[model samples]
Target: MSIQCPSCNSQRIITRDIARKLGGTTGAIAGGASGMAGAAGGARVGTLVGTIGGPLGMTLGGLAGAIIGGLVGSAAGGAAGAKLGEEIDNKVLDNFQCANCGHCFRQQD
Candidate 1:
């Protein structure tokens, strides 16, 4: 499937393939960022839980929670970021115009 930019008509469209690639790259970055954030959050939670639950609880629960939270956060962030990135790429493709013919071209894979 292809996306057409209404402002530019059919002149500028973003191909699904290119958009996917852009999304992949964007998702990777976002995933890493999210993972880091999740890990930090998990650590904080672990600390809190440790204090409340004592040493044994902290050792088991904190470790498990951190791993699980980090993985889940990374996946969600990656997917969300990929979608947003694809949209932005589409917008950029839509606005670009050819200097010679004033024709906008859709991004190609």
Candidate 2:
């Protein structure tokens, strides 16, 4: 769909996406925090498996597990947040800017 500025009636428009960016960051932080549980579980499993090799292997395994768990959680959370933010941007926020006049407006249905 084409976007036009209400004030200038200019066809040059851009999306601000302010909420999407914020939501992704916030969601990532929250997801990482929640992932601590996953990390702990991963560590336990990794340590058990690494036991065959000894202390050094166990240490490495635990570290790897924690990192992987946290990363996975953050990724998942970020995606969810971005989706929600996009919806908000489209439906509730004035997410578009007119490149010609610097006007911000929401798209009308």
Give one digit per residue, the lDDT tens place, for model 1 in 8-46. Answer: 455343244455566766776677677777877886787
**Over all chains combined, what TM-score does candidate 1 have?**
0.50
lDDT of 1 at 40: 74
Measured with C-alpha atoms, the lDDT of residue 19 in candidate 2 is: 83
- TM-score of model 2 vs. true structure: 0.90
Q: Please write out the lDDT profile of model 2 over residues 9-67, one tens digit for every residue.
A: 99999999988998898888878877777889888888888788899989988888888
Clash count of each predicted structure: 2, 0
C-alpha lDDT (0 to 100) for residue 33 of candidate 2: 78
- Residue pairs with colliding backbones in model 1 are 11-104, 13-106
Show model 2 residue runs off by greater than 4 Å: none
Query: Once model 2 is optimally superposed onto the true structure by TM-score, how far is the C-alpha of residue 92 displaced, in angstroms?
Result: 0.7
The lDDT leader among the candidates is 2
Question: What global local distance difference test value does model 2 have?
Answer: 0.88
Q: Which pairs of residues collide in candidate 2?
A: none
